[model samples]
Target: MDQWIKTILEEFGAIGVGALMLLENVFPPIPSELVMPWAGYSVSQGKSSFLAIVSAGSAGSFAGAWAWFWFARRIGKERLANWVDAHGAWLTITRDDIERVDHWFNDWGAAAVLLCRMIPGLRTLISVPAGFANMPPEKFSVYTGIGTVAWTALLAAVGLWLGKNYGDLARPLSWVSTAVIACLFSIWVYRLVQQRRTGSPHKVR
Candidate 1:
């Protein structure tokens, strides 16, 4: 993963950063943690500009989020549920969870979409629920844009700072990324456990 990131940074620079962010939002496997910091390192190496990197990353995120939004609109809830039931194993979303997501969309509306972007795994899945709930396109776009920009800027800054440290930056950055992901995962797991214990289902409301 590290070598692939370095190669992309060396070869494609800011464009690579943007593309990765887009893929991360759509696919969920691509890690922005690796991409943004590498872009920062590239800037430190005089290979790219910080503004360009951030811009690309943000644009990619917006595009990806928009795609998901439209997808939700097209598929709607019943069809999506059917599709999930058939292929849910691949994505790991359960029937109960899908129903809960639908409930969240109904209760919290677009704000749930925005908050989901800030979360790790929930980010991609929220789009489906947002679609299921039939959230307003304009509101969804606005909130999604805000979340994407904030996330992109935060990651870019971390990358930039680490880039300055050169050889020393990689280890610390890796450790930090691992810790952050672990913490986020733990919190999510805790919430899931709590929800299960309460018999309140997985939906936020």
Candidate 2:
């Protein structure tokens, strides 16, 4: 993976960093923790500047987020609610739950989207709720951009600090990413079971 990342960074420069970060948002398995820091390390190697990498990465993340946002908008709330009603048991969600979530997102979406963008597992998923709530694109972009930039800068700084030791941290970072995903899945499973047993949606809100 390191070789692949290095190859991409070497071949495409800042564009590769943006592409990787875009993919990282669209596909959760591609951890931004590794991507941004690695890009930072590349900066250390004179492959690119820190600002360029961070800007590109932030742009890519915003694009990926917008993709999901538009997708939810395309589906529309009525259609999504109907599907949830049909598959609520398996999904452990209900139409009422969807409405509740929509309301919650409407109320706190700005903060939620901003804060979640800095979180490992929740970052990508947060965009979905924002979309479902029909958040204004301009507002969503503002908050998402602010958070994404901050997160990207922080990760890139880590890479710069790691410097020659970046390789040493790769494995540990991968483990951390895997653990976060596992923990999120575990929580979902627990919620599913609880909802199933009680015949009620488990409210995380």
Best by TM-score: 1
Show model 1 residue runs off by greater than 4 Å.
165-168, 171-205
After superposing candidate 2 on the true structure, give the runs of residues whose Cα lies further than 4 Å from its correct spot. Answer: 81-104, 164-205
Superposed Cα deviation of residue 130, candidate 1 (Å): 1.9
How far residue 32's Cα lies from its native spot in candidate 2, in Å, is 0.6
lDDT at residue 79 of model 1 (Cα atoms): 74
Candidate 2 lDDT over residue span 1-205, tens digit each? 5557767888998999999999988876677877887788888777799999999999999899889888888898778777776666655566776676567667876998898889886678678789877889999999999999999999999888777655555565556556755775686788788877876553322
Give the count of colliding residue pairs in each prediction: 1, 0
Global fold similarity of model 2 (TM-score): 0.73
Residue 199 displacement in candidate 1 (angstroms): 20
lDDT of 2: 0.80
- What are the RMSDs of all candidates, in order? 4.8, 4.4
Residue pairs in collision within model 1: 37-159
lDDT of 1 by residue, 94-135 (tens): 567778877876788777877877776777778777766677
